[model samples]
Target: MITSELLEKYTAVKKTFSKNETIFEEGNLPLYYYQIISGEIKMSNYNDDGREFIQGIFYKDQSFGEPPLFLNQKYPANAIAVEDSEIYMLPKANFMKLLEENPSISVKIIENLAQRLYYKSVMAAEMSTQEPEHRVLKLIDYGITHFDFKKDQNGYLINFTRQQIGDLTGLRVETVIRTIKALEKKGKLKIINRKVYR
Candidate 1:
């Protein structure tokens, strides 16, 4: 998890993502590691046909684009904030220096990437074997374990659209809708207008 002291060292930038704004696009040169202070960022990509697809969703207190910064590599996917948000950015030079200066920080970064990879592997397996609804539940469970969702009463408050969730889970939007509707019908989840709860 990220700490306030870590944030104190970085410059906080007040930026807004008007509904759907691209923070960083895929194939761009890796620059800074951004920490979300508020709001959510939807990491996604587009196919060769120019079809947009969501890859993952990140919320507050989480960091993104750090893994590929090991040696200033290009981003593998696009990152866009779901709503207006603020981010604390540590430029590559400062970020790498900070880690090199602190062994503990480097260890934390390694552990964070390892954990993310582990969950991604699990999601991959689930995508091959589970249904769309089950995949969504698994994503929720994965988020809960990684982000401490249960610690807050509001849960994760993921602001992604159904289509975005489908992209993340490798399911179609219609499948996501049907699965969510099924979950709501079973009283396993709450779908109030556009928001989702479990």
Candidate 2:
């Protein structure tokens, strides 16, 4: 992630959005680099039948939709605010200039992109060949590692909702519910006060 100081030096503009608001639509030209300052955002796409497939969820200090910026292509998915959120947006030209002028920041960006690519590859394999339970567990494990989850005496709490889990794992919400219950029964995770902890 780029530091606040670097972002400020580049004159990133802070913008806010309400819950369910579209930040950018799929197929739109990538014109800016966006970094979350507060709340949650989801990058997703809808099928012909209007079924939603979540690409990823991002939290504060995280950037989204950067691949297209670097590749000079249209955005592959829509970005929406999941809650009232604030974000910093830098114009594409300025962002490119920033990277050009800051070698260390450019290296960090490359590392971030590589991590995302790795996650996508792993998830692709899980989706194609894994059972529902296995896919769900793998997603939870990935979230814990990628999101830097904090552990308590019980376990690491996952911050995603059941619906979000279903979307991310390509399962229905009912299936997610059933699989999570089964995982709990098998002592794989804990369901405390209707929230999941792994």
Candidate 3:
């Protein structure tokens, strides 16, 4: 239950944030590692045009803030909660000790990082070879692998804003909107209130 003993040994702190709240800003000192207890946190970077490009989204049981642990510097991207969320914080030193004590956690962390890299590669490949519609489908497939994108009589239910989808898939917002509309027309997808039913 996040006891003081646990806090002393691991430098853990429990935090809750509301939707649209920034957990940590880019370029700020990366003093702690974070693990999501519940809800969604998005990691995003700013482009030259000052647009936010979503790098990744962390869900329940995911850990982030490890890049800074490796680099010994500030955060590369901003972490913001997409919904109300709880996270466990660990200072760098204590986190390393936990890794040393339990090697399996380290393995899981490495695997998570590898998966993130794989997603980026897939996005790049899709951008070069696939049409926008196919790209969206591929992304939905990936999400199904990672989350629960269930299909019913109507379609699949997937959570994401069109802008967020565009940010991750490297599609323009207009293109994403048009592609969703096309999918709806084709009877392959139905988007209602920002949720994709496919």
Best by lDDT: 2
> Candidate 2's residue-wise lDDT over 1-198, tens digit each?
788788978999999999999999999999999999899999999999999999999998999999999899999999999999999999999999999999998898999889999999999899889999999999999999998777998899999899999999899999999999999999999999998999
lDDT-wise, the better of 1 and 3 is 3
For model 3, how does the per-residue alpha-carbon lDDT over 71-113 read when each residue is reduced to its tens digit? Answer: 8888889999999999888887887787788677678778887
By descending lDDT, how would the candidates be arranged?
2, 3, 1
Count of clashing residue pairs in every prediction: 0, 0, 1
Q: What is the TM-score of each candidate against the true structure?
A: 0.83, 0.97, 0.86
Is candidate 1 or 3 superior in TM-score? 3
Candidate 3: stretches off by over 4 Å: 1-9, 150-155, 192-194
Best by TM-score: 2
Residue 3 lDDT in candidate 2: 80
Model 3 is weakest, by summed lDDT over 10 consecutive residues, at 1-10
In order, the Cα lDDT scores of the candidates are 0.76, 0.94, 0.82
Provide the lDDT at 110 for model 3: 88
